[model samples]
Target chain A: MSTTTRMTGRRIVAIAAVALFILHQDFWFWESTALVFGFLPIGLAYHALYSILAAGLWAAAVKFAWPDHIERFAEAGEPEGGESSGGSVRS
Target chain B: MTPMVIVLCYLALLLGLGIASNRFFRGTSRDFFVASQSIGSFMLLMAVFGTTMTAFALVGSTGKAYVRGIGVYGLMASASGLIHAAVFFLIGIRLWSFGKRYGYVSQIQFFRDRFGSSRFGYFLFPILVGLVIPYLLIGVLGAGKVISPISEGRVPPWLAGLVVCAVVLVYIFAGGSRGATWANTFQTLVFMVMGVVAFSLIASKLGGLQAATQQTDPAYLSRAVQNVEIQTREGTLIREVGVPPLMFLTYFFVPLSVGMFPHLFQHWLTAKSARSFKLMVIAHPICIMIVWVPCVLIGVWATGVKEIPPLAEAEAGKVLAMMVNLLVHDEFVTGLLTAGILAAIMSSLDSQFLCLGTIFTNDIVLHVAGRERFSDRQIVWIARGFIIAIVAVTYVISLVAPKNIFDLAVWCFSGFASLFPLVFAALYWKRATVWGAYASVASAMLVWFYFFHLSEYGHEYALWGGVMPVTFCFLAGAGAMVLVSLLTRPPSPAAIEKFFPQQLEIDQ
Candidate 1:
């Protein structure tokens, strides 16, 4: 089994996302009048699938490219002090 | 009559929930603004997603689809899904950490601290508020457009806008961000579920899904070109093409606006943990799919429905309401769906209202006026007062405003998208200086207004050949930032060290 480095994994996801953006144009489907499931227009069907794919890509990005360093930085900071709750919530 | 009754009840219920949520208010300026950073994954998903999905999704997209065809989804939802999440991952998370580390409540605060310029707020604040006013108006206007038809015009559009603004104001006034999150979570569910139900009900009324789509003109189903002359900044050319490839391609930049939305910035800060963003990011595209597919389909389907007839130029925004009222015969269901659509609109409204108030209180009143002058309680009151004023102003403006929800949203989104460069550079580019940031914003607005003026603010305006004004505005901002930053001194190393945690880690 091969292990993926963080940078390589991020690059792969980034490239894939860019690829998806290009694919989003869907020129092939744009002029096609065909319907998916006999109800969905080809352009609409293509975009629906594309949106789901984009969601999947984001999930992958989150898993692989999560900025762990920022979390560490925020955590290392001293806790916030003196939260005041006396103010009114109304005008 | 029954539908009207139900919608009234639903509004009353929402107001009731706002009062209930206020009981749990932590009663602090921070809690009022960002819910004291206590929102979890699901609620964070709901609030952020709900805020992003405004009248633009339901009313605006439907109207756009009615005119432009199903390509509206391709231009908007699919693109937003990819770009918005990327923004959240890169910009949102990093800023959230900065916010938590420094007790930064507003985006302006982060910008001021990052660029080491207090005067930056004077320029950025007005731009933000101006852009956000259109966004806020979108919700109020959408609710008015939809509600009147649902009630058979028994309730006037003015009254509808007034009721929505007032309800959102009351809730936000009491519950603040926490109430907004709770309301948004509830409304998000209402709209998503009801959206599917409305989709099915409408399609069934037209025979079936296939039959309903068949009712649409084929030209309205495809993204093929149409011959239409458009006014551009250069001058009007007798060119004959609509939704050209360049225009379609450039539409991608428009969704990048979410990266810079003030309301969205405030919502990002409300997350309880960094991990909470995962659900919102991953699920956002799919959630967009759920809402947009139906609304766009319904809009296109309205073309063939005899019940809907034809709409005048100004009547486009009312298409969604017309369809729901005419097709779905169940009075109870219509009322429920009206609440659902209002749910979609109001969710964004409350957040925008609260965000602007937070900005006014934090950026101008506290930072500019000097914090020592006002008591903490007074500061809270000022936030509440500002929110009321905004809601009031928005409601008044909505009355005479243009009814083209789609065009209004595009222009608003374009302004924010144009500013995305400054935000991106501020976060990642250590060389980004205060002067460069100012140039970026100024260049963006100048270019944006230039195109807008040439178009006469027309709905169908385009640039050089077919690209939207946003494409040029975004480029100008990016170009100016790069050019001006190179010409100017780089940000101080101490400022870079403050914003760039990796550097701080290395130093330690």
Candidate 2:
């Protein structure tokens, strides 16, 4: 993919992840009459699945939108031992 | 052996572990507070997860699930898994960077420097301490609930509270942050294992998951609110099925409090590197699942079990302990499960106690009296003194037997959630001003007080017509922050540059 396309894709993924998180909070699915595997409450099961998806989305967020400065901080060795403030800023 | 003896032995083992951790203490205030920032990933994960679990997640959550049904898991647990990890990734990493670069040991230090006013610490110190005291009460109250019941009426609630407070104080005073981290890690493992064990034993004793769940009221299995009719001494009355949909939806904001927790902020600074956070982000949700799934299920099972009498609303907090005692039957297992629940409660208590002490000593005293006047040894002593005083105050308050553990926790978490806007803006928005910070704090607290008073007066207290109190409080804080900051002066270029150095070129 081109640089612009990749950036656009990343933005779409980030936005989608955020939207999913917000929508997951709403109880539209609470109206569902279905039960999970005939035992667990459907609402309870939905959230359990929702939680796993949330974890995956956050993983994507780390992969794509992980702040460059944080990566630099990681590469720079022990954060506590370092004193160079300017090292956190990239040109 | 009796359950009481086993519990006493468990307490003794904790004290032993606390003293053992002291051998690694380096005798510096830095080592005392942040453990010299040498904590690795697994320890960091365990410590952070343990501190967040608290009695709120174990005792309070199980009780809440009993009252509210399966919907209880969705209200906080499931959402928390994601929201907490997001907070860790977004807020925690940035704060860790700032803390490392600027040598900040507490949240108040960051706010003081960011707002360009040392006086801001004065305004913040008491508010943060007041908020934390309620959070501390959750643990103390929970410890009392777990211990008092298992030991029967022989041990009063106040005695249980005293034992928990004294045990935590000994470890924290001796080993400081390092000791708390080690204890929290050990406690986290103990509680997670015991939680699953208790769930399995109880479920089997109640004739397996399918049969147990089948025994519960059908309305209890659904999110759709229904009028559950029950026959009581006062005659038949109706109870609501589960949490209202809107209230359940708005609970997503409560976990956002993790961003502004002074205790968690201190934990963030203990990371050896930003890389240390990677494990926390990935594993936090998974770990939350491990702990909460069993608690919620067991709580749901309690509704169906016929062995114990139906729990009155007021007696909901004892559901978990009652389940273990009635179902397990063995003194050893019951004592072990009680210890595990207490482990979860004490893990958070030690951290909160240590954080309050660190804040009082570093933010209030050292900042006001001047650090040069106090010796390093004196500083540690000052922190220890404040912790002891706070523990005494919390223990005394727990004796009064105030609000339900879960209800009190929601109010406490709400206060922290309302303040989330202040910290987020301070870090991410250059236009964020000291005036805006002031306005945000004032607005959030005022709204919180109004709702709190309404709750006391028996009002449902939803804001903006059925929206949760946290929604309005967060908006009031964020809205005041943005509008007041724009109308007022932006932070100085120098102040902005400190936080956002790369933006200096763009601004120029």
Candidate 3:
């Protein structure tokens, strides 16, 4: 396979790993913790999670969403007739 | 003079600047809305710093650390800053690059242009502006409340909020980003001085950090995994703490969506250079440290106080207010500090209000009205009017919302989180289509609101704590976006060529 396909495969695998981690947390951290340790530590852990996640989510949004806008936004600099409004249009 | 007088003098200074900056405003819509794209690194730093660190940092976060002990010092105060620094590294540089390339004015403009779909603009702008306005209003209401009591009821809360709103609107309207930058520079100095005075005095009184820690329990200083779960208001449950490895992964992936927020992107679009952005990335970590550490310490310090301020039990945000009131006995310092806090509040409020105004006027209004090339005079008034209206609405929402500051803050940014997937794809994935963006945002919001907000209020699940709502939203939304975009045909090469010429060039 080409280098492009290799990178895509790597990204997909990385995404899968993340998906597994989050799913595991939902089970182990949220469910298993309460069963073993009393609720206080679990509550504290959840509160920490809430705060971190809020900020984390926003940062994630930025990383994922910004490049597309940058590329799309770059269209305005293009010479006319190459593209409509100097943006990508699928034929 | 008393702190109150110092405060009044500060307010007078800000008002004078507002009036004075108008001459330099150039009366153009773009200038009024975005400071004519001439915002430098210093101005941008002040604007971002002054706005992001607000009454929340001053009172709320510290108060939390005080009550919760030192756990907050480690997690909320320190970690948040560290994470924000990380965010700047991952996303800030890219955002600045786009902002320069597009001459983009608002977050919505970036979104609309990126998706190459005007429809996405219509969907995204309202939700973003809506979320931001209430958050801004809440800041105003809280500041007003803090100021009124600090003045010994000499100033009314509603009046204070109104006065703040009016002053902010005038300056923001008059000079736009320039006004925000100049005002923020003045404001940041005031806040830092007040912070130093207040923290120093409190530390001395409490026999310094070691004694204060002992008094408040040394456990606060320990970064152990103990007591992570506790009984909340609703019932016994696990407390959400720790940067779970899962969340750390999300952090790596999630900043991928930074392009989605209109206000955040405005910062991007207004950068002087990619180098300036890079500098901001390097410097911002230290800046976050300077700002958050003292505030958290103050909070932890407040916990040791024998006599607490009233109403702190009901709300955490008011803890800082009570701390300020409890600690400061002298009138002069109080007035100066009050002015500083006002500066902090206005710093955030003015920037947010301007952001909201630009989003509405530029993206929502102009797009819907189907107009182009509006007169400079018309644009300025419209932008100002939108700001005033948004502030008013937010003020009312803050009064009536009945949510805790922490809860509200997290919720306000929920859309950004939920929409992260769609945004990431648009940026990095060449095949990401417009429908994918819309679908991802919708799916994430639906799941988030259902599980986190509505489910809790509706009392749907007391025992079912196995699933993390955020994780669920991330997977569901992100999965949907990729799948949907893949299923759909890609955009025309011609359209892609016009809009994404750089990507094409880079590819070449």
Best by lDDT: 1
Task: Choose 1 or 2, whichever is better by DockQ.
Answer: 1
Q: What is candidate 2's lDDT per residue for B239-294, written digit by digit as tens?
A: 77677767877878899999999999999988888878888887888788778877
Q: Which candidate should be chosen as best, given DockQ against the real structure? A: 1
Q: Compute the lDDT of residue B392 as modeled in candidate 2.
A: 86
The best-first sequence of candidates by lDDT reads: 1, 2, 3
Candidate 2 structure lDDT: 0.80
Model 2 DockQ, alpha carbons vs. true complex: 0.28
In candidate 3, which residue ranges exceed 4 Å CA deviation? A1-91, B77-79, B225-259, B309-313, B396-406, B454-468, B498-508
Give the Å shift of residue B91 in candidate 1: 0.9
Superior by DockQ: candidate 1 or candidate 3: 1
In model 2, how large is the Cα lDDT of residue B222? 65
In the range A1-91, model 3's lDDT, one tens digit per residue, is: 4545545554554464344334323333432222113212342344344444434443443333223434344333532221011122111
* Root mean square deviation (Cα) for candidate 3: 7.6
In CAPRI terms, model 2 is classed as: acceptable
Q: What is the TM-score of each candidate against the true structure?
A: 0.92, 0.92, 0.77
Residue B408's lDDT in candidate 1: 62
Residue B160 lDDT (model 3): 78
